[model samples]
Target: MIIVGKVIPFVNRKRELSSLNNFFNSDRAELIVIYGRRRIGKTELIKEAIKGQKAAYFFVEQALEKDNLDSFKEIISKTIDNPLIAKADFTWEELFQQIAKEEKLIIILDEFPNLITENKTLLSKFQKIWDEILKNTTIKLILCGSSISMMESYLLDHKSPLYGRRTGQLFIMPLKAGYILDFGVDSIEDAIRVFGITDGIPEYIKDVCYRLNSGERLEEVFQQDKVLFAEAEVLIKSELRDPTRYFKILKAIAFGNTKFGEIANYTEFPAPTVSKYLSNLINLHIVNESYPVLVDKERTRNRRYHLSDNYFDFYFRFIYPNKSEIISTDRISGFEADYNRYLGRIFEKVSEEFLKLNTDMLPFRFNRKGRWWFRDKEIDIVALNDNTREILFVECKWSSLNQNDVKHILELLKQKSGHLRWNNDNRIEHFGIIAKKIQDKETFRAQGFVAFDLDDF
Candidate 1:
């Protein structure tokens, strides 16, 4: 057997795919709805699950209704091993009815939103057909689409024709940290660094690996390829009508504006208009809104927003904006220069997110986790354990930590602790400082503060 590379089959979705299979192995037919943003591996998952089975695959195009119906009919006829239907003309209803009457028939309507757009009454007609004929039959109908809004509107929403008809809806997302080891990426920090850049979308991760060997840097591979330069644009342009506005909003978030008002001001759009766009963006899972921890200030303008997906965050931050500079110069050198300039900041943020992921291993889960400011003084991290009433104060320094760094963090904690009045009789406060490389480990240990070096992971 001449295998090219390791076939990482359905690398991390064993449980999800198994559950979906279990559901399909039931008495009657099932209506499964699967969707996600473009290139997030929806089709791959479905195809892998339905491999070697009696499955009909129809990828609906943005075309005329009659043409789409013809295409769908062709797939259905071919799937059933019917050679004669290549010359036969069948309407959508008749073809679907024939499929419904069969056993173990799986029909996948990919890009269903485009089909619905091509013909406005397709879902209503589908609902009528399902109610009258297909519902009682044994045809497993799987509808798939990339347009998050359109998919939700047509099937998942209350005001849609196919609402409440779906047996299961699967929103496929990118891979997370838990799957890093399975993908053959070593070390949690290294895995997180990859996630920071590639964002765990399988296609993006595979692309990164295709160019970069196991020990190679992403900036090297990403800068050499113009394909990655316009990747973010390609993803959004396919689904969104006006890419510029969404791009501006995304860039604003990537540039470090976390609140709606901040993003609007930075992007120079009106607040209400920005809000509407944000709603649409969040609905598509491109961006997310987060309320402050330990605070119920959601309605009082305290809810911050960011790109929910990590890959886009990396793209907007480094690749998309720096495309010309990267491609037009000595790719590796230019990339290294830019990377060295900003990698410290990126690592700090990654370390913070890592801490969130490993809270189970921590001494306490803090109710509040964020940076705090008072005039010129700033604290990098503050987490209060509401349950245990213990406080965790952390300071992250990219360079080697010095006496000044320790003194600064201690001063900030002293100031804030008194103001908040959060001390019990126990007064068990845990202070921690993280560095890219630790300095004076004995001194750090003497101070009863946890110090983490970048190599610790």
Candidate 2:
């Protein structure tokens, strides 16, 4: 029988899988660190890499230190083949010694941060064991962690025991816009909306499409299922200790509190504490610090925070507020309400991201562009050239672009140019409009601004 919504056994990670395979096949033993937000498929990727190969895998559990040691011993015992280690009361050093006996063994320590919590001395123990034993052995060690904050502390921080010991570091990011084609969601618009909404987190995307393929709309799937309703909570609870603080911080950002003061005010947390928390949130990949497109330095007014993960943004904006209604039988109505409330904004964000991706894919373009602003006015896109010192200002309107729309964007671009200090210093050649379907492209061109339609990308 088919296991519906199963991960389909690690499809489409050629680069990552090859990288690991190459390392394993190389002359020297390697220690690799793989990290990402929860459900971005780090564990699965590692598992897939070592599936057919001779390997020892340990998935740390949230238990006491002794239990964790026992669990690890069990996993090693199952894979180790030799009867010697099957019942040996060995230290971590002795364990690595036994693992080293293999010609080319792959050792994966998964959820490494959780294991560190149970045994505060684990990293130091591992570090000592690695330097004295494992590093010189033929065993390849893969340390994977979901807690970026803790992972960095253990493996990256200068003061930590494992610091400066890793041979390779790989920060596995969310799937890019190009990856959707691999997943068979080909339509650019549909891909952008789905990708932006789910932010390429494999599990969330799988959940969404699983529901959609099962004949459910975006709204109905999320609203009608308690399983889906708890997704945001599950995501938050995975990495954070006090999830309430993170929940409040996420809600604040979702509601458009980009500034630290705004987030502080919303969460009722002090500014310094909020600053620390935001740093942690960024480390965890839940939120990001967004800046003006042209700003060279980070400042209070230029910085804004947005949810880095697409699924979190969609969940908070649409699912979280209407959770009670969504988890009920009237979920269709709840979804309709959420759709009406968010579909417009979500559509706008998706359109802009589509342009961004398209711009990046364009060849020979030294500087790809997007929009920026200061106080009063905002821009849709801003393109700059390094050699020529020229700027291409663009305005993206998601909806139909009529004469009135053209005029409004033209006026906005004009305002943006006036506010900038470099308008006269840098050569300004063109202003453009990006839209779904321009009713009057010629009319806008005649009005002295180039018009780009949906197919421009």
Candidate 3:
């Protein structure tokens, strides 16, 4: 297969692979768009999908139009056994036509946004090419990009020339903990310590696997990936005009300034400006503006901002804050000082992701789930099955807990669950706990409550 980047043993991509397989089997040409934030495995997935197929793989970088077009011509000509493309200069339209004419082909333009920036009119230029020459051909064209905001705005936006041309689209997200954990982490605890902070991005997962196996602490893994230090900076600069200000806003949020006014005050920008910057981040999928866990008819209430990109969040939290010190030495003393607290918080998020997929942790087909809090009470997990009137209340513990500990935490969960105002009288409630490891699984099961250790995930 023609691909870029190191070969990752692709896993848990059955659905995505099936979608691409359908496109490949289609009788006519197909135009597909795949995108996500960087290092979430978009290129790997495409490479896996197009394996053993007649395909042309072109990785578009930020360069002159002729440079990118020259690369594309070379790949297409090689894949199709046509030497003319490399022997002489060829136009983009002519190259595409020659590649698609005699064979069923898969054409992948990876990092497509970089190509567009080099030549703004290439979007319409390719659209005209497709409509005029390649529309009824046997080629399946997949345009992939890393910038979520740019991909959506330029290619998928209603006003863009390429808007109505796509046959399918996929937003490849960060892998979940369950999908990433089997990479042979030493233990469940190790998985959470590393995967929790890395947010299941495959490349970061690989880094963690290498670090812990080599007897390094989770904090030291951060030092190994020096390239990641500048990753957040590059992403913010690419998407925002004033990244210095944006960095402050993101750093403020990472450091527990989530409210709109708090972020504004922390960054010393006006609230509206904070909101506009946040919208840009949200569009880029770098930030998430989560409303309350439950759906509310009234839209403008209980909105909270969070950094959704795990690496960006970790970088802002750990790396960006101590840039000078980290640059001095690969190791940062006291890196583990606040690590336990951070692990506790992220374990809840990791458990929430596990609960989304593991039916054993949740029964009765839950329709909604997330962290929930009222005036002074916060529930680590609150899952609802509206049809069955069941609510699963859970607490995630990064530390080990025994039967007695579980009893106390379950009691606290019941107390906090009491504060939730949704369908209180009509809904049924069940309590549970997820820990790094639980001492007594059967003790809670006997009481008809769900309980899990990391092994269950």
Report every candidate's CA lDDT: 0.72, 0.72, 0.80
TM-score versus the correct structure, for each prediction: 0.81, 0.84, 0.93
Error of 1 at 67 (Å): 4.0
Candidate 3: segments with Cα more than 4 A from true spot: 1-8, 361-363
Residue 175 lDDT (model 3) = 74
Q: Look at candidate 1 and tell me the lDDT of residue 445.
A: 59
Top-scoring candidate (TM-score): 3
How many residue-pair clashes does candidate 2 contain? 3
Judged by TM-score relative to the true structure, which candidate is superior, 1 or 3? 3
Whichever of 1 and 2 has more lDDT, that candidate is 1
Worst 10 residues of 1 by lDDT: 1-10
Candidate 3 has its poorest 10 consecutive residues by lDDT at 1-10
Candidate 2 stretches with Cα past 4 Å from truth are 1-15, 51-53, 63-80, 184-186, 224-226, 264-273, 298-301, 328-364, 368-370, 402-404, 440-457
lDDT of 3 by residue, 175-200 (tens): 77666555666456666666656787
